[model samples]
Target: MSTANESATANPTVLHFSADNDIADIYRAHLPPGWSLDALSAAPDEAEKLRKVRRADALFLTETPLTRDHLAVAERLRLIQRQGVGYDTVDLDAVRARGIPLAICPHGTPTAVAEHAILLMLAAGRHIVRLHEDITVHGRWPKWDYRSRTLGLDGATIGIVGFGRIGQEVARRLLAFGSDVLVYRAPGRPPLERSWPRDRVRTCPTLNDLFAAVDIVTLHCPLTPENRGFVNRTLLERMKPEAILVNTARGALVNEDDLVAALRERCLAGAGLDTLTVEPPPADHPLFSLPNVVLTPHMAAGTRQAHIIKAQAMFENVRRVWNGEEPLHRVV
Candidate 1:
């Protein structure tokens, strides 16, 4: 990815910060005319990052948290556009206090993120990582044991925690795999934009009910104040001993300690976690040592295709903001 920071341009500058460095080239390649792109280089300090934001007319955010301090100095900032659907990292109160519109680009998220959730479900269910390590590192081929140890999605019951676009997409894919879906929508939420097929899709009145009924529980909900760490000890204990957990959503949506305990005690089969309470968790993080866990650096939606689509949408929103129009999916 190119670090072509055309900082000299007097045109409107859009500052972008993302953990995926490869996305820089794509964002620069799709740059709107006369708009400068400042992709924050390598992991800069908080002070330096805030300094760069001072000159930005719009902030294209991902991975980085925008706090009150950053917004205090963002005098030129007119808008903040999130690269994907979740805006949990941004300080909503601070952004609102500043009266800056915060937007999220969901154009390329549903399919990629949902597909990743499926990937995790499969990998965790089958203990793919453990088998691979056993063969490669230990020189043991547990072929016979694999049959009795692993599970498959074909006949499994899956509980989907949120029924948003990504959740619905996950249900669609799971149905194709011959799995049943149990959806749990939050109470008092607005009606779904679309309905699901009745043949394999049904609603679970409560989260505990869904956890108990399914062979696998995959979380697709956002991390809000009310739901943060909702997947705690009590919830984890509700699942069958053979059931696994898959989370492609925000890491803090789960309680890391509780999840670790469940996996350690063999009360839960395994977990496929793409997001964690902390990004770049310490080397000594408990989940790092668990054999039944499959973890990624929160890259479920980090595919090049998704990033390209996100970049285009972000620039289009930037254009709209400059034209004195609201962004496409403005959340605040």
Candidate 2:
């Protein structure tokens, strides 16, 4: 990936905060001929630099939270293309008030994230992390007491909070394990896609019902103001005592403080998380102290293949916006 700043062209300027230079290079290559690309640092101190160069025609945004103040400075900016699926960090209201279309590369994330969610589920169910630490770090051998704590996926009922692309993919894999799948979709939405055998999967009427009935519950829903902290004390309380929780979606979807309390009280068996409310959370984050929780940095969609696919979709949308055509995955 070339880092040298290319000469400006006659075409419109597309500004991006180069958090991942390799992905940035992919974006640059896919852009239409004559389009010019400019890079900015994703750090807060560099935001002023972004404001000074406010003539960008479009933005390829990463995880940096774009506030109303930031948008106010970019007077000519017309589109915001997110490289990944989650948009909770970007201020949608500000974008909509400006009439700038906001889009995401949803086509690129499902498979990798779904696979990660399953990995978390299996690891939590089997206590993989704790067992590895027990043997390698403490030099303890496997014993019958440790074996009694582990749970198997087979014959267990699994509940998926949101039946989107990733959730459906998870259901497909769980079925192969001989697990019963239950799904809950937001109100007024259509039924699960017909391709997934309807008889093999059942739909729950409400989140409460789903939580109470399943042996494991996984969240794949996007985080929004209305649904922020959707997995709270009340929902966690409703879950079966032996049930495990897995989250591969946005971290804010589960209230961290509440989750900590649940683990402390053993209200739930365990949790497997690939994201948290804050990235690189404080060194003393409570989740770190719990033996029953397995945490991974937010890398569910970080696979090489997913990156290529996401970059392609992101630039394709950018090309459409540049051509004054409707974007393929408009979210706002």
Candidate 3:
């Protein structure tokens, strides 16, 4: 979001974009010699993060919303390395305007998020969360009754809403479960890069067709302005009454109010969500009242192994920029 000092190669300072000390430590573990690091406090205020960003040559950002105001003060920033793949939290236009190289660590995200998507798919499909709550907290076992409600991945026709790295990973895992995979068609999307059973993996011509045909739908697309809240009532209505919905991509991809209405009306079977339109959702969020939904705190890709790998990439990019070279995986 800003420029490096004239003597960047001689010495450089880095800022940890978020307040997590552990994540800062992960990046610190890989810090180049003669380089210095500063970390924000846990639960830091906006002003606090801004002050730190202004003084650093590079930053390792996680969830903090890096906006134009922060960029304006980033007088010494030459590079920004997102800890994971998504960059929706950062103001990309502002970063570009400032001529700061923005890079992402895609290598850290795919497998962990893809695995969590399938976990939620199975958890929500079989009502595993409710089963645990009922038996563990209420001291009741409704084992036989559950036979009528349970959904399984085996022999199921599953639709994958996006076909990027995470989507392909999901398809691979789905195959191991004996499920057929249907990829949705988006303009200019590439063909499958690897082999899968031809009959089991192919594209669905339209969102409507995919929504109607699959036993379950899992979202793995990036959040874009054009597709924000695209999964509204009309799209949801096309899904069968027995079908389930799973979203691990971004919260704004689905219309939460519409989803709540659909769930309450029994128009859809259940939902497995790892994100909400608003993070740290208000205590009375409508989704909390539903028995047919399984929710996780947007941690689909929060693995330690991913962190170390990301830190390595982040510093390597920092070193590149410090040495007057381009950053790898540059997003803007």
Candidate 4:
């Protein structure tokens, strides 16, 4: 038998997976030079996909949902390696049922994601993306849009909705612009002003305080059942009419319908969203019609550096599994 078969029959280990094109390349680069990787552009039909995955010891995924059925067929599967922080795409309960450890990149993508959030904030504040599209795509060169808008970052207050790693990094970048920074984090997890320049940024006493006081509110929190619709009508109503909104964190955190209504009523000045309530929001989604809303296809961690870090993180976890060591970044 061939070495692959010998290994599969003897150790039952193979790295099986799917990931975005760029992420997949990074994964490949992190592996040994001669190692081969199997990839599926899209998960094929069940029997076929299972046949392709049957001998695998681990699976790596990004974006594609890994349900119970997907895991059930991989009899030798020992680990599930996720490319980034969020494991929502991988069903934890299913992994538990099969006794497979799930791993994610622990120190992965936060810096890149944080940078992306700051970029979104600036883009939204200044209508940067919209203006660029007008100049390049619509041939509106040599001038600005008749209804164009802009917000000066200097002397403005930026409210961070979550003060996690990415949120703190966003705060770090905001400091360069001399903007006043206010943060709203879970109780007992207040902002650490010492970690950042104390002269400019300050911590808010409450979430409402941050919402009421800032010129721009950027979301950096995760999506959970309790906070899924956190940015609904009530919260949107609390913002200053001219306050801009930015979310690079996750989609479900905001109530899309309420946001659309707020935009329609002109309650919000504009928004920059790298994520949406659903990935690739339907073409007819109401948010698309708003001239002030800037939407990206969740490309915040799209940089090459971020991709390499993610790949390394996944490989580290795979190595741990191969050696019978506990996987890092276990989600469930």
Candidate 5:
């Protein structure tokens, strides 16, 4: 309940932008006493909110962005700590232009995301989504003539697009399932030098080769400008007709319309997506009608464990900034 100016012991004020009340509470608890905490339902835009009133010394931004316009008015803003690993929402170029420090909680959501990817893969492969829908929409349904389908993880090649922390964790998990893992990271960046399980993974020379080789392709890369629509018609066409695709990464990485077309034409077996170009897509979206596609409302990193881990990491970054020390996960 303590407001910003009332506590004189803490000179600089800190504002947290999180819609979730529980997340705000955890952040507040970790902040040093006397440093004020203000929760906003959304990211601020106008100068008055960012500059005059909130007086944010450091910002903990959630889903919404901290754009150049937003940062322009925050004169005292020294650090922008992201709650999640992805920094797409934050304007990194502007932050770097202003010489402001930015940090991300990479360790927070990797495990949850990896687990969710595996869950989606299983759900799509076993026809769990369609079976459940049939049970609820009509009644308990019996097996159809096409029920002989089975997707075993053993001996299957799981292709991972990126070799970041989350991708590495996915590789580790899939290895335990007796699966061969193929990677398409920048060449010469071998995993053995970094202590990762290189024995279980083979590096593909290019994305095209990776797509042609694997039984299942799981995306773990960021949706940068270069890779925004990476999984378009051509890439999807190269995938084995019976191959599966999994995405716990950014939604924009896959072109929705193209994916829908591929599914309709049976170019690929199915897709399991934890994200879409739009969150909570309209009820009438075409993806809803596709029994071959399994969709989730961007909950790849929404686990309880992930929540605690992200909150802790965010606060630790704040603590380091508050104490005039270097932050652990500086991204910019």
Candidate 6:
């Protein structure tokens, strides 16, 4: 990670302390005229560096863990702006203790992640990987046999776990494909009749109900300590034998070991994962050997359009905090 500081008048500084410099540039370009922007590279003494720059009004954080010690020195810090939707890496408890706002770019992520989830569903359902390998690698022509195993979205019952921005977007697209959408969110929330007709979209009271009923399930929830490994063997067993599982959300939400076992035993038909319990997983990871799994390097929100939108929202929230207004998408 590298760092750069942009000087602009005597305005409060916004620290760009993330691994990606491109994100810093985005912040620099969009921030209001007088606000200062500073980029800090990841280092062994990162906490010490934060101590030195105790006047940062906001932090655009990615991958770097904001420990309690770092927060103690950041007396002037008003907001911690996550570059993307997930804040699993940040110490939320400490952030709240300081009364600082923690905001995410929710608007920027929905379209890209939702589209990726649908893409994965189609790829896994159609056995695209295997068919491509058969033709391109083995020189086999026209692998029509794959068609028998392929599943279609039309008339399929799709369950979206977590009815937030990303989940709702996934539901919208699936509806156009003529799929029945079932959503499972926390209890006590109002029905989603406003977004979709009550007759068209059914609500599942629990994960078990959703898993048992849907032909395909996509995860769009954030990863938190309480929900870590929520999709374990017992819940997975409830899914239909031919059902496809798609996850564009955090990897730790699902038990990767159990997922592999389910796939190996043929209890589950297929899985499309953009994230893993461990990113850049080891070469010998079991999922890599499975023929029924499709994997991407957690790039569900990596679209160019998403990046620009995310950057804009990230700094906009910072500007909001500076202007003494409540930030958008405040998680803490």
Q: What lDDT does model 5 reach?
A: 0.79
Off by over 4 Å in 6: 1-9, 42-55
Q: TM-score for all predictions?
A: 0.92, 0.88, 0.94, 0.88, 0.88, 0.89
| Candidate 3 residue pairs that clash | 2-77
Q: Which structure among the candidates has the greatest lDDT?
A: 3
lDDT for 191 in candidate 4 is: 44
Question: Which stretch of 10 consecutive residues in model 2 shows the poorest summed lDDT?
Answer: 1-10
Instruction: Assess each prediction's global lDDT (C-alpha) against the native.
Output: 0.86, 0.82, 0.88, 0.76, 0.79, 0.83
Model 6, residue 11: C-alpha shift (Å)? 2.4
Looking at model 4, the pairs that clash are none
Error of 1 at 327 (Å): 0.9
Better of 3 and 6 by TM-score: 3
Clashes of each: 0, 0, 1, 0, 0, 1
Superposed by TM-score, candidate 5 places the C-alpha of residue 59 at a distance from the truth, in angstroms, of 1.1
Candidate 2 yields a Cα-based lDDT of: 0.82
Residue lDDT tens for model 2, 20-69? 36767776776667777877655536555556338777787777678787
lDDT of 5 by residue, 152-262 (tens): 678889899998889888888998989999988865675544555667787888899899899899999887898898899998999988889999999999998999999
Given candidate 1, what's the lDDT at residue 222?
A: 87
Worst 10 contiguous positions by lDDT, candidate 4: 1-10
lDDT by residue (237-329, candidate 3, tens digit) is: 989898899999999999999999999988789999999999999999999999999999999998898878777878888888987788999
Clashing pairs in 6: 4-39
lDDT of 1 at 129: 90
Query: What does the lDDT come to for candidate 3?
Result: 0.88
Against the true structure, whose TM-score is highest?
Answer: 3
